[model samples]
Target chain A: MDKKGNPQIDLSQSVDFLVFWGLKTDVKAFCNQNRREKTVQLCNLSRTEKTMIRVNNLIKNYKKVEALAGVDIHVKPGEIFAYLGPNGAGKTTTIRILTGLTQASSGSCCINGFNIEKEVRQAKQQYGLVPQAINLDQELTVQENLIIHGWLYRMKSSEISSRIDALLDYVELLEKKKSQVKTLSGGMKRRLMVARALLHGPKVLFLDEPTVGLDPAIRRKIWALIKKIQTGGTTIFLTTHYIEEAEFLADRVAFLDQGRVVALDSPERLMESLGAWAIDRLVEDGMETVYFKTRNDAERFNTLKSEQYTLRRVNLEDAFLDLTGKKVK
Target chain B: MIHGIIAIYFREMLILRRRLTRQIPSWSISPFLYLTAFSYAVGHGVEIEGHTYMEFLIPGLIAMSSMTQAFAIASEINIARFYWHIFEEFQASPISKVSYVGGEVLAGMTRAMLSILVIMALGFLFGVRLNYGLAFFIALLLNSFVFASLAVALAMVVKSHADQSMLNSFIITPMAFLGGTFFPIDRLPSWAGAFLNLLPLTHASKAIRAACLNQPVSIFSYVLLFAIGVLFFSVAVRCVEKAKD
Candidate 1:
């Protein structure tokens, strides 16, 4: 203990002391005011080592209907994690619980080590959510929307203004800053949502159906923008119905079905686990897919050899279908 | 928390500012029609409780206008919830429900205050100047508080914009006309007076009319309106919390 009866630690060993004693709060209080710089560095270092978004055994029920049974997810820092699920698969429910839009019936969600239910403000500050719907204020200008987002995050006006300028430019929406959101095109509105979400500089971004209903070109633009955002070291937790979008972007993907994660792996590994090639055969009821280790092996498969089949490379969707027995919608 | 409240209020004010050109005139027409029609056409040469009809009607208009304008916030909230989805954005933000309700209630009070000003201006044009003192403004503020809180509570309870309209038609419209806005409550039958007195607006109209006419205002009216405001405000916060759930 120090002269004030506070815990004393050598300055050089503060980080180690934190690890050894597991007394982050006490150390934070000790490092308050005088060792501010050290405190920030220590906290940031600790956060970097922790999972960016952690949800454990999350469940949700609407009356008798179980929306999410027992979902578990751990998103790593600076990686693009995709949540792929069919309709009614509880993908949105997981995102909702993590983002604090709704509560999980049971279990816990932590964003950058802050529990969403208990440490709401800190957890909320750690992440920005781009919801599936376009929730931007259509009556306001693009700059105004970003400004409001910043204000909601408790950012000062000067900081909000500077971030708005930088984010609008980053989103390629600088020219549309003065334009009302209602007048913007669909892609521009989507881009504005991205700018608004990034205004507070959150460590994690939750993107729910980020590229839905967009044309191929606009979708590619958003994908590139998402990639650029990830390169800036912001962890991305994405839920998308488009399976190829997951294949093209995700560092790792989780396939959810009936409120449970059926498969979780990197895209290449998930496809490789099934095989390198997939044969699409028209069955009596519907189409069926068969996986093979090689194109030659797929050619030699005796079951679909007599039937008409198209040889194609395996994709993430085929793997999802194989694992969940349900198409990723 | 204060910053979050300011941010939400700032957003509402921004939208209001953008629509002022349309809103100002829309807010003006009702008062203008009442002042012209009732003060001249209907109540000319009519004096109730030793005051000209115009003098008596001005404060009633103030109370009614403030109530209606404050309650108008429900429509804006409905639009945000139903069409803009801005409420979802707020839900995803770090703002507390108390701050959200506080901000919305403040916006509602502001709209009420503006409508009161318009009515005061209209009364000035019609040569119906009243006391316009501290008590008058306080009563107006309390009345606005009651209705604004009610608006926020009802806004959250209503499932759709159409239900909001139905609330206005069923609750606000009847209260505006029957809650001693255009006439004296005591002049009616005792049963009717007793029933109307049960409405919060009756006390608001009584307190405001007494203050504006420079008559002795009852402390009960002030106390009761304040109590009702607090009750409605609590309900609003609770409803917002439930809506978030």
Candidate 2:
């Protein structure tokens, strides 16, 4: 209560009200007048919590087939968000829309607060993409490819040369800088794609199946590279069908089925919500799965089962199958 | 936008440099065969427009070579689009559609000029020389611009390599032979001359021939070529936008 018979509401207590009322102009002055510490904390919180990528009801249609039936996502800065789906589940379509390679039928999207439709150039400048296919210029050497990409982004020659060297060293392809892209192996080509994407220092990296066809050993190497990239405070939006890859790399996982997100949560939380263990029974018709809350319960059920059954710990794939009634791959 | 276009242009130049040896021989062989066989054998006793047969054939060969070289961009664009997916890289970047069309069109024009220079060198070997003036170069440039713009527009619409080859065989090959390259279109039947006049290459060949002979070149031909180039350039930008979308 103040002298004027009005309630003295603290700005810290109603941060949302301040934001909703468009009080950003007077925030600094109001904070300096009263509750300076609280206001500073709130301002810092808002700054740190800024969303890097935002999508609202994004939808795409190809004639009759609804490729993406309205997807909504918000990714924070410095977060690795994995988009998991089967083939033709709109994973690539959503990525294409985000990267501005294709236009959406409706809805809106933004990267680093720039609208993709209205502020297209600025939005594109905020992110880099590594497509599913090997889209490298086969006639050019690895160094030439990076140089051209840098030039496309309007980078200075001195900056491009230094950045190319750093990126090649980071991807462990420094020795192959002069080799033509066609001569590189599949894994090397994939690494080169990653290096090329990072050369411009984009705020967000969109990787469409970065390790799609690589063997397990090379896949692990790429996973390590992805983690290293995230450590540099760049947001990563990764699309892959490998459940284990999502579970191992993502801060949060989104499971899309038939152009809609069926489940989205942290991998541990999603797996834990289903059960701690699962039993796979080889039935007459097909393989049936049963989930149990504890290992002892799973073992008990396994012994009582007459048919062949194996008990194992619940993983992201189990959670996906349980949610969508289909496998990730 | 300019930087992105320069990047594309530089890449094409690098590829051209690497394939220059193979390209030079192929581009020179056709003109050599045309000059040695047509001018020396069939036209040894024939003269046209107060010039020797070899002198008349030189400017026509220049026009044909320029048209073919400029239109050759369609094959490169098709390869980039279908096999390498290089256009996707540009589409995903911040480059404008105009920049992409401009860069590719310029590359095509460069190829045309180089091929013209090669044909001119071969003309020297045959002891056939003509007026190499500002008007001759301007006509060649305008001619290249028209075909290169058309090539960019066609490249956007073509689906496969076979489609590109079909266009080369059916459209380009006919224009090269019948558009006054080997003979004068005025000597043909009235209906055939009218039909050939509709093709831009006919005007290109006439303007190039008149300029090379130091005769009065028609202002209408240059205007027509410029208009056609502008029309096709606009169409190419639109097609690029559609393809990206």
Candidate 3:
């Protein structure tokens, strides 16, 4: 016991305690107190013991073309992992395979240790999917759609009713519950989809371009909602073509290009590996981006005085362009 | 599996309830028109096999209407697939193939039962009453089961609404007119009668007419309808499994 009547937890046991309780704020506070070793220990524990999604050497082949070739990814619990790519770059294909909508040609995947192909029902119970298409039944009211989802998940009637109320409120769609899906605006429909996906309290949530067609204002609201969901301890696997969305939302980002992952890291680290600042020059054919170590270095580049160029912070798009020599659409 | 089937059936019932105001009227229109036209035009004093022509035609309409209404579920399935994309949601869900087929088949059967009731009411208004017994319902149930299972199977295989219409023309329309619905197969040539006897609907119409007329219902016809229903149900389940792939 400590002098102030609080229990003095041993260093070795505190890691397990914090992890078991999943008190992110307390862990962050402890990590801030110069506990580098403990922080590393906690991270390694999470990486090894708490992988929410694990994919190893996944490949998908169509009749003539390979959509995914030897892809691997490991997503940590309660973190937002983004799969960024251009059009037809296998982002949706990977999501489809992981969600069990498509089968991989070779490799294996597991959700929370349940092999998707072998233990399909158990694996499916571990995650919820918010697909890109607005596939809600337009003839049914928003509340009815959610009720059907709850029943499919096999929840009790009472629990389904309670969760419907809570989730509709969580997504800020409580007022629109009685309205038909076709009557909803695009943003409202997207929000309702999120609510329906979360109806069963899944351990993992798959968001396939959740904010794809929404305006910037609504997109920002969705971003906030995603962050809130993460805080509630749901692991998020997001796939999108929007570079800035990944930069803003993902804790770790994987850049997929032509059925291969070109780069994988935190968005900041991926950008920082090249440089901190970028200078874009209007070349003969298109924009050519040049990176520099510092803003002053970017400003004082000799070509800046002679050519029409602009300086800005390095972004994920710049990093992707650097790695693959192509832009993410 | 049971819960999944109930969930799917519940969704279909909700849609049916909401559209009932329009659907009930539509269900009544055909039987009403058919009864009025047949009874007035050719049935003033006609008798076939010791019964009025309306008595003969009522059971035929019952059989034919039940077959057509039950098979109409295919259009609903196609609309949910192509327009609403609700089938994708079912695919991603943890529900088994049998549960989905069961729920859809049940919905189809419900539509058939409702149409049969409408036809019976129309028959009553025409002053033609037959034995509404357990055998009559059993035959109608088997008939609905056959067509509903067939509907689910065909819905899975068709690529577009146009293809579904073509299937209706090729499979259902011909069966409705030629499967002993309007006239007894004995009235045709022996070769034509043998060909029509091969249809499941022929047995369905025969058994249904025999039961309503209080004649000894043929147990062979009952067994044949049940076997055809099971075969079509197996095919429907297989098609749904293939769809997932």
True contacts kept of each: 0.77, 0.72, 0.63
lDDT of each: 0.88, 0.88, 0.87
| TM-scores of all predicted structures | 0.90, 0.90, 0.90
Give the lowest summed-lDDT range of ten residues in model 3 chain A: A34-43
Task: Tell me the lDDT of model 3 at A46.
Answer: 38
Off by over 4 Å in 1: A1-49, A300-307
Model 3 - which docking category? acceptable
Which regions of candidate 3 are displaced past 4 Å? A1-48, A302-304
* Candidate 3 per-residue C-alpha lDDT over A1-329 given as tens digits, one digit per residue, 9 for 90 to 100: 99899987677456545543444456555654444343334334434677888887788988679999999898988899999999999998998888888867667677876667766888788899999998898989999999999888889999999999999999999998899888999988888988888999998999999999899999999999999999999999999988888998999999999999888899999998999998888888987888899988988894446788888899999999888988889
**What does the interface RMSD come to for each candidate?**
7.6, 7.4, 9.0
The DockQ-based order of candidates, best leading, equals: 1, 2, 3
Best candidate, DockQ: 1
What is candidate 2's TM-score against the reference?
0.90
- Give per-residue CA lDDT, model 2, range B1-245, as digits (tens): 79978988888888898889999999999999999899889899898988888888888999999999999998999898888888888888888888888889989999999999899998887787789899999999999999999999999988788899999999899999998989988899999999999999999999999999989999999999999999998889877866764
Give lDDT tens digits, candidate 1, residues A129-236: 999989999999998888888889999999998888898899999998999999999999988898888889899999999999999999999999999999999999
DockQ of 1: 0.33
- Give residue A74's lDDT in candidate 2 (0 to 100): 81
